[model samples]
Target chain A: MPARKSAQPAKPAPDSTRRSEKSRRAIYEAALALVVEVGYPKTTIEGIAARAGVGKQTIYRWWSSKADVLMEAFLDLGEQSLREAGPVPYAFPDSGDLAADVKAVLRATVDQLRDPRFEAPSRALAAEGVVNEHLGRELVAKLMQPSLDLYIGRLRAAQDAGQVRPEIDPRIALEFFISPLAQRWLQHTGPISYEYTDTLVDYALHGLAPR
Target chain B: MPARKSAQPAKPAPDSTRRSEKSRRAIYEAALALVVEVGYPKTTIEGIAARAGVGKQTIYRWWSSKADVLMEAFLDLGEQSLREAGPVPYAFPDSGDLAADVKAVLRATVDQLRDPRFEAPSRALAAEGVVNEHLGRELVAKLMQPSLDLYIGRLRAAQDAGQVRPEIDPRIALEFFISPLAQRWLQHTGPISYEYTDTLVDYALHGLAPR
Candidate 1:
């Protein structure tokens, strides 16, 4: 839900809006830090409110559950990372050269993965998601699906350009670029680097078998 | 360590050996069950001993820590699954058709991932491993490395047989076959099926680009 767009009307006054934004940012920070310090189960809405220096009713007024708050907090974190990386558009690049464009995107992903602020909380939530199927699906739907859609869109363009095979399923094909890095990070299977991701893109685009 | 080999001498008497084996099996079962029920941190040697109806000293005598015991128990579970699958050699199959051999192996893996006995405890351990780097590396080194090695061996053989590109690094190339399936299972990203795995093999070997 990071790039969600909706029409807004009946906005609050400027002073109240500023205050609300401040409180919201505080809540996001507190929720992320709390999840990292103590895990998902122990991170309560009340605890987040306390850490954020707000009332419990304030959090309840917004998110219905701890999971809701945490998911939003994660989305906000991704946006923050993107902002820090500069004012880049929120679409996968399509430079006509499929390999170069994908490599550029994956290199950016490598930087994001190595970001310490992103690493701890991401792992905490991801660990919980592994065992909690409900939250796992929610994470995929809300957090992952958008990024996956970008990959799909770019691959479709590649197919149109006669770069990728028209018959290739973009959904499964995207996994070849991302899943290896994910498995290595999640399972400690191996080290991750720009070179590793570049290699993944290469292997994925070109067959492992001889051409 | 399912296919671990070691020289054995100075064996115990048959009766004592039988009793030891019975007790060891019980400990493994108890450990696996406890982890699934209450999770990794709550599981302890005392609890496993009580559940297994053995002295704490018995668990201590064989294993030094809960992680140690759990790793061995998982290895045992894997061996049990293999035994039930019929007597097959521990090496990766080499029929010269890399795609068929890999697909066959991944199909068996899909079955194992879906097995009732393997599912719960494996999830519990995997969930913990995501957050705990120490335990995560141990899990990879002891439980997963063997299977990865098998894939590496098969890929290397494919290279030798000129079925694969000589320059492709088998270590990373093998991830194309397994990591997609792993991500689906671990993250609930997609449904896993024989058809899905077969497609992965086909895509991996044939490349995503048109020939």
Candidate 2:
């Protein structure tokens, strides 16, 4: 009877909502820090709960598992970075200039990749994802797909504008601009810089073969 | 003094050499199996020794670290694969058709990547390399660079033959052909197939824009 009553309680006040937001932020921070320090395999929901000073039930009420928590944390971090960058949150700009817009977003991505605060945690998660197929697929679907959709959106705009050829699949065409940079960053295959990415943009847009 | 004398004993007989080869194969198999079973971080020299029916001293005598052992194991696996495929070991064919050569090599890579025997262990090491910068860089230098050099050699041949534009940096240009395929495989971004790779070859050799 008591459990049923608690479950059917009225909505919380604004103050309680504020408190909930604070707990959420704390949980996110705890999850990211734990993953970076102990690695993804060792990070646990209990650890996040203890570190966040929240109950395990509080986390269970919100997310299903540690992977869910970590994925949301990463998404929140990306949003925060975007907000701090002083742009419209999460929109790939379309100023009717496909090349410039892509170059701009990619340059920002290069900055984010090199940022010390983001690099370690991202690397930890990505490393785990590489070997864990289920986690990898989930990360791609939940965290990465949104960003990729933005690229696809922009590419479609380019195609509509007659800037990108209509025959090209936006998904495949987008890889030419992004994957090289990603491969270099993830694998340490080469040095990453705005100049290098800018070159990639030029080559991808203009094509490698003689026009 | 007796131990030193034993260590400096006379040259091995033909039978002893055959036994040594068997031991070497056993060690390589053990190392690969351990890495695939337990992952790179947990797979140690001692564990590999136990699995191989070898002493720690044997591993130490042959290699300095597990990384060295695994790297050599992977190199050996690559060589064996090449030999079994009935191809000349370690050379990218240059038939004076740059596009055909690139396609042929990439197709072979596709087969290698799909092979179940190679995939699991390779993923294990590659996943480790993503987070371990030192190991990642070393992997690139030792294992990947040899293959990359083959691409560079082929591009140079193309330039000489007036098929590829000489002004284009082969290193940067090569990324168009390789990085997209790699990212697809590593990240599960898209499907990989002969038709897709062949399209990459055609698109790369000719500019995307109308001539």
| Top lDDT hit | 1
For residues B49-148, write the lDDT of model 2, one tens digit per residue: 9998988887787787888888888888988898899857578888887878889988998999888888888888888888899999988998899888
Please tell me which predicted candidate would have the highest DockQ against the true structure.
1
I-RMSD for candidate 2: 1.5
Error of 2 at A97 (Å): 2.4
Q: In model 1, state the lDDT of residue A145.
A: 99
Pairs in steric clash, model 1 = none
Superposed on all Cα atoms, the candidates' RMSDs to the truth, in angstroms, are 2.8, 4.2
Please report, in order, the local distance difference test score of every candidate based on alpha carbons: 0.90, 0.83
Model 1 interface CAPRI class: high
Which 10-residue window in model 2 chain B sums to the lowest lDDT? B1-10
lDDT of 1 by residue, A68-154 (tens): 889999999999999998989999987789999999999998898899999999999999998999999999999999999999999
Query: What is the C-alpha lDDT profile of model 1 across B161-202, one tens digit per residue?
Result: 999999999999999999999999999999999999999998
Tens digits of per-residue lDDT, candidate 2, A1-211, equal 1121125237878887787889989999999999999889999999999999999988887888899889889888888887888856668989998878989999999999988878988998888888887888888898788888999999888878788777877777778888899899888899999888887877777765655
List A-chain TM-scores for all predictions.
0.94, 0.92
